[model samples]
Target: MQYRTNPDYWNQWYPSDLISESFPGQFRNWFYSLLVMATVLDNSPPFKANFTYGTLVAEDGRAMHKSWGNSIEFNKAADKMGVDVMRWMYCNHKSENNLFFGYNRADEVRRQFLLPLWNAYKFLVNYAILDDWTPNGETLPILDNVLDTWIISRLNQVIDKVNTLIQNYDPFNATLVVESFINDLTNWYIRRSRRRFWRSEQDNDKKHAYAVLYHVITTLTRLLAPITPFVTEVMYQNLVHSNNPPQHIPFEGEGQGVMSHESVHHCEYPKADLSLVNDDILDQMSVARQVCSLGLSARNQAGLKVRQPLSKILVHMGDYHTELKPEFVQIILDELNVKQFEIVSKVESLVAYQVLPNNKILGPKFGRQFPKIRQALVVADHAEIVKKVNNGESISLDIDGESVVIYPDEVVIQTKPIEGLAVGADKHMTVGIDTIITDELATEGMSRELVRHIQALRKEAGFNIEDRITVYYQTDGDIANVFDTWTDYIKEETLTNELVSGTHAEEIFTKSVKIGKHEVMFGLKKI
Candidate 1:
């Protein structure tokens, strides 16, 4: 009847397809069947329709029902957590799988993805404002740093993955790809390159960082626009249109183009730059990160904090481990607070090994021979057993004149740290930390701790990152000597223009922290 009333509307837009309704969606097919029966009886054409189906489940893997009192009040959730979060959760959740909707999940999404993305953008904007940086139509500088190149490559890969996944109607994987890229951009790329932005000079390196970050954020906004419209549009407006006028599309006349809307929805989707994708460097970086992580874990097990200095970390890798370059190894050194790093062919000197029979399998297989097998394993030369295992060989023991060959899988190899070493290992690699500390290392650690305190005071005092301050620290003996020895390093790190050796006025921010065994009082005054 409506089509008869508006025939032009029917000609332009007829036979609309319906989306998957919440529950009891099979009724749609019944209604469509009625339309078919009517059309057949009247000798008229039936309206074309399409049906999509999915199951709806609640946060606890149960159906949403008012009788069960498990129904979600979406309006209340939206009021508390924004609509973008709900939309993000839905898009990232696979339709084939049940969505575990809850406030906790929403909070995780906020903390993990949204907060990091926002913080990255805020970091750029804050520094850019301080530097008076404005976006110009200039290409990024040729950056030789692997961190920069790696992130660019990862960004392009993300673009490709997101486009493909979305095109294939897999919004779950598409949003997941974006989430991973955001993590890389925030934690790996921005974190490693922060010093370039922190520098007072607006050099080419700083410009390159800015260009990369700006391009990434803008492209990310465009990519996320379809799934998360409101938040992306707000970000696009603030990040892009705030600095410059709205972008324009070329019109017919020369120098005449219509100004485009500032909404991210209006922007075009990002295409991957195949030239920037480097899988090899990414692999190397992944290895380096793993090494650093293992090294840090070893230190933690040794009760050595990262603020303290260590002498060396010895790394032993499996056959499949990626060979890292000197620069990549340098990342380990810088991050692990170690003076030296060595890639060793053997870890016999660093780790002691013990071989034991796996009772779960051996208990039933050998029966009476188990005792002899256990004895052989206990008395077996651990070094030889380890060597055989490392070479992918098994150990053979003659038990009561009977030869029994025990495969590596039947034995458990437990690694114990040798003297003066702390060890951590995964299936792919092992890291050993030399826990020896010298006077110099202790002094440096103390100085670093003191620097942390002073920096915290600066923040408490509302001092800007670039603000200079006068430092007054009071401590005796070795710490005083530390101050004398590493005075320049401390001053440079804390932006201290004046370093005085006295108890200053109490009006200035003052705090006392235990530096080693000595309790030290420190004060900072903004200069």
Candidate 2:
């Protein structure tokens, strides 16, 4: 009847896209039966597109079966984990590859993406409630802050990218793109702009921050609603319907923010505003992240956590990225918990590079002239040659007016320590952390440690974020001096009414921690 010649609705049931199980012999079974029927009835091949997905197996590659004790019912899994998590896993993989689906993989997905995403949403809701912020159906406001600008730009970029991929029937890449956007939402935008939300003032800057986050989240949920419906609807109902409805948010194409609808599924998909996408700002932010990554790596190499205050980190500059401005450097400093940065234009200023030719590979290539090549590598401009090699470019050596070209695989380069600083380098960025910890820096680190413990205690004690608490501590003489030195900072960070040196009542939340040779006890009492 689908292919029947009729005046009305002929080929109405003809599939534009055919999707089915791709288990072994399905082509000769289900597909073969259809082919036989079509062949006998004089029908042409029907579908315009056919996407065959692979079968799922256990994470360890076991085919699931009840007898094998590896089978997981879809309904049970959905109930235990979540429909969103299961759907995320489904949309995250290529159709050609067999997905390793199981409870463990679900847990991994929950921890990696879902939890962080929820935390970002929770932060927004909690803080907005405290500030009594209500959505006015207002669009994103222009802000001078780079983080605000960058997040908006990033959101639009992700929208464009995910839409393009999904339009082409590629949900795998589209889902990955959304996952990255969530990371930006949780780690970059919210984490960086948290102070603005927590501050007492309801200035234009704070308003802009809230508006940007709201826009990004609503747009993101609209994009994901087709794939994962429940969580998106829940978030949409609480965030939008409960906050404000009956306002038109005109989007590009037919996709408009819901004006009359209550469910996220009732709303149209979000449209990307390409005009808001700025590659320059994205590139600049990428450079900032690379610097932070390198700085953190240096700190890890130096046996220093991010809480430890380093005097400075040295950035070995390369041509891969633009100059790091003061604004970007400040972000790097805050992220890596370093005091300052010394960016060197020349990498030679950072590393004393030593180049060694691979004898096994070059010996047969250079033959009798191998010695000349070896000496050429030794006396050659080691810095430039190493740079070329690191950049995957061939190194040019002039040995006694004889030109020789050396490929990257032909040599091994090593970096010597400069003043015994801990150094880390990748293909584009190299950074070194100053290992010298002065008394001031150490004391600051210890104070930060105290604040971290106090904040944890507050959370564990069920104290509200805005609750002012008295932090009581008893420590040795050295640790006591650190508290005295940075008491104001600790109090401000922990929202402490006062820092009492003596012990308080046993009813308060208190825990003892060892910092090297000293044992310190910290307690928090809500005021």
Write down the lDDT of every candidate, Cα atoms only: 0.78, 0.81
Report the lDDT tens digits of candidate 1 across residue range 339-430: 99888887676788888999998989999889989999998888678767767797899888888898877889988898999998775577
Weakest ten-residue segment in model 1 by summed lDDT: 249-258
Off by over 4 Å in 2: 2-8, 11-25, 29-45, 247-260, 364-368, 396-404, 505-507
| Alpha-carbon RMSD, candidate 2 | 2.8
Q: What TM-score would every model get versus the actual structure?
A: 0.84, 0.91
Clashes of 1: 0
TM-score of 2: 0.91
- Candidate 1, which segments miss by more than 4 Å at Cα? 1-24, 27-72, 246-261, 375-409
Best of the candidates, lDDT: 2
